[model samples]
Target: MLLQLISHSLGWLSAQVSAKAQDALIAVLSSGPVPQHVAFILDGNRRYARSKNMQIKEGHTDGFYTLRKMLEVCIHMNVRCVTAYTFSIENFKRSPAEVDALMDLAEEKLLELCQKGDILDKYGIKLVVVGHRDMLPERVKAAAEKAEEMTKNNDRAIFNLCMPYTSRDEIATAVQSTIHERLDEDADDTVTADDIEAHLMTSLSGSPPLDILVRTSGVKRLSDYLLWQCSEDTQLQFSSTYWPEFGMWDFVPIILDYQRKVWSKA
Candidate 1:
């Protein structure tokens, strides 16, 4: 009993120390230019689950907690916009049971965020669900709309949750919207690149230009996420850490490297 107590105490103390160290580092990092918009491609939840011999749902749940923690870190860093590639349209091809589990989780989490004193309320962050609403389960779609409506007035920060989304689809939708609007106004149907960009989901949601896009589990590809939004200047960061295990420390180096590159360019 004594040994167990001592071990627990030490663990608690170590965590506290680590947290303080992280806070100090963040403060220093904040002294420099912080990215206005940062996007994350959440990957490797299933692989992480398999590695730990746990259910895939448990891995996703763990990833959600990691995401919450990373958002808090981003908020502290005063990142104006944070976009997470929560789910891709291609993810729908997964087993029906897995897809159903994901939908249930999304519904639960969206409603939880709408509750009083949750992350959205605590940080005054606006929750924007960016994707095909028709593609989501009815319950999930309702929960997403409710969350968005509840936090529409928040102006402190913006969180774009991209689920059931694909860059190709977004571009096509934007081009279509642009052409329809022009036709309705009796203008020529020539849709310029700028016109399509103005109608992009990210633009409609008021998200800032993406500055950095990080994909975990060492995945170097964008996987059809935000293809149009990623300009030549956007930094692409890849981490070997799985989504479930990603933490503040894992993110710090990326930010530092971004700062170094920006400062060097100046």
Candidate 2:
């Protein structure tokens, strides 16, 4: 009984410490230039799994927990929009078993989010899946559609899941859409870059130009992600940590560095 009491006491203390740390970060970020729309390239899951001698599927599952934690921090920071690179179109090249596992996990997680969508409700966050939905499994697409429908009325925040997406493909699709729209008009209409962007997958959220993009696993390259959205002032932070290891606290130094180097100058 004494040991049990001590364990409980320690847990309580740890929780308090975590809460205080989060509050401190939020207070500091609130005073500075906070990113309106932040994008994350969720990488390094396989490496993390390899390190632990775990299956690739287990690594992806761990990454989902990190995403939940990230969402909590973003909500606390009052970020207007957050985009996660959930899956890339190139991922279809993986082994069939691996691809199947990933698709199953994605479907499971989406349905779980729908059932427990109070997290979105708590923050009044609109959840939207931006990608080639037609290529997704029927059940996965159905879940995504339901999640979007359920959160359609929300306005405080927007969470975008870029599933089966690639920046190059997105840009190409946008261009095709713009041209198609122009062709629909009887008169010869000029199509501008802005018109193409308006048709982009990212445009669904009405999300502003990506203010900051974080890629984990020490990757410095964009890897065909968000090529068009990256502005001159957009701050890019490459984190050495694996996606499964990313946490709310890890965001502090990155944001602070951006403030010192980019936002302060702006």
Candidate 3:
């Protein structure tokens, strides 16, 4: 019911009458102290594929296109950093064929983002892969490395793709890095939480932690997402639509609603 209202309201917004492409939405987005870093839990690809009786790879393909669209929107909206959950550490525990297909998709998408990625390049998006890279296949690593290098000069936004990442693994890696940093510097036992955060490879070291986190598939749980960054004032919005079907419309209203809560809505 609520989504219907939002959909109807936005449906009437055509390009001719559209004021600044999302003037109202952008007004709301700008009103608030905007989210510097936002993360996404992209889920329900397999389920969506099954509902359509299509191959899982087909569903992943759709999801990939959705990601491309949203990244473009994020660039336009000026979201500083956006992270998408691509794969988990335990995903390897799935059936061999399914796991292999997922790996192939990841590898393919990595290559796409690297060599022929005009959209990302056009928007000055820097690609950063977050997760246990050591666990990834050599080919995937090469693709990710290539993307990072290809987009290194671009700085309009940070696109962090999480592959083989899990909250438990992130914590363990943080601990290991903290220990290594202190020992490497020959520092005594006076290391604090701030020191550990500084050693973190991603933007968790920023002054303001994650401001908004979006999880699709109507899933309420964070489920091992952003263990260190989501502190107080963190906003969470869930979309029942699968990640493949999610678009800026899904995100725009939610941010507008949130903006109303944090600041005056336009």
Candidate 4:
């Protein structure tokens, strides 16, 4: 019992020290340019679970907490908009049991965000679930809607959860919407790139232009996430750390590298 208590104490002390160090680093980074909008392709939860000899669900849970911690740092650093690739449309091909587990987890997290005094409420962050809502389980979809409604009035920051989404689908949907609008208005003008962009999920959700996109687990590909928004100016960062193990230290260097690029361009 004493050994366990001592171990817990040491862990707590280490976490406190790490957090203080991170805060100091953030303070210094804040004085320079910070990315106004950031996107994350959180990858490798299953691999992380395997590495830790844990269940896949447990790895996903840890990934969720890592996302929360990362968001706290982004918010503290005054990042105006953040987007996460929470689930991909391709993920539906996984085993039924795994998909069901993920749905349950999504519902639980969405409902938690809807609760008063939660992170979204406390930070005045608007929660936008961007994707094919009809594809979600009824309960999960409802929870997502509730979370969005609960935080609709917040303007301080935007948190976009792209669940069961694909860039091709988003773009196709935007194109269809743009065409339909033009048809409804009986306009002779041809559809423009700007018109489609105006109907995009990100733009409709009022998310700022993406400045940086980071994919953890050393993945270098975009994997059909935010394809249209990743212009030449967007910095793409790939980290070797898995999503569940990613921390503030893993993120700080990406920010610094982005700053360096921005400086060089100037």
Highest-scoring model, TM-score: 1
Candidate 2 backbone overlaps, count: 0
TM-score of 4: 0.96
| Location of the lowest summed lDDT over 10 successive residues in candidate 1 | 187-196
Worst 10 residues of 2 by lDDT: 113-122
Residues 219-260 of candidate 2 have per-residue lDDT tens digits of 899988888898566788999999999987678888888778
lDDT of 1 by residue, 1-266 (tens): 99999999999999999999989988999999899999999899999999999999999989998889999999999999999999899999999999998998999999998888999999999999988879998999999999999999999999999988999999999988998899899998787889999999999999998999999998789999999999668999999999999998899899999999999999
Please identify model 2 stretches exceeding 4 Å from their true place: none
Model 1 alpha-carbon miss at residue 122, Å? 0.6
TM-score of decoy 2 = 0.95
lDDT of 2: 0.87
lDDT for every model? 0.93, 0.87, 0.79, 0.93
Q: Give per-model TM-scores.
A: 0.97, 0.95, 0.85, 0.96
Best-to-worst ranking by lDDT = 1, 4, 2, 3
Instruction: In angstroms, give how far residue 67 of model 4 lies from its true place.
Output: 0.9
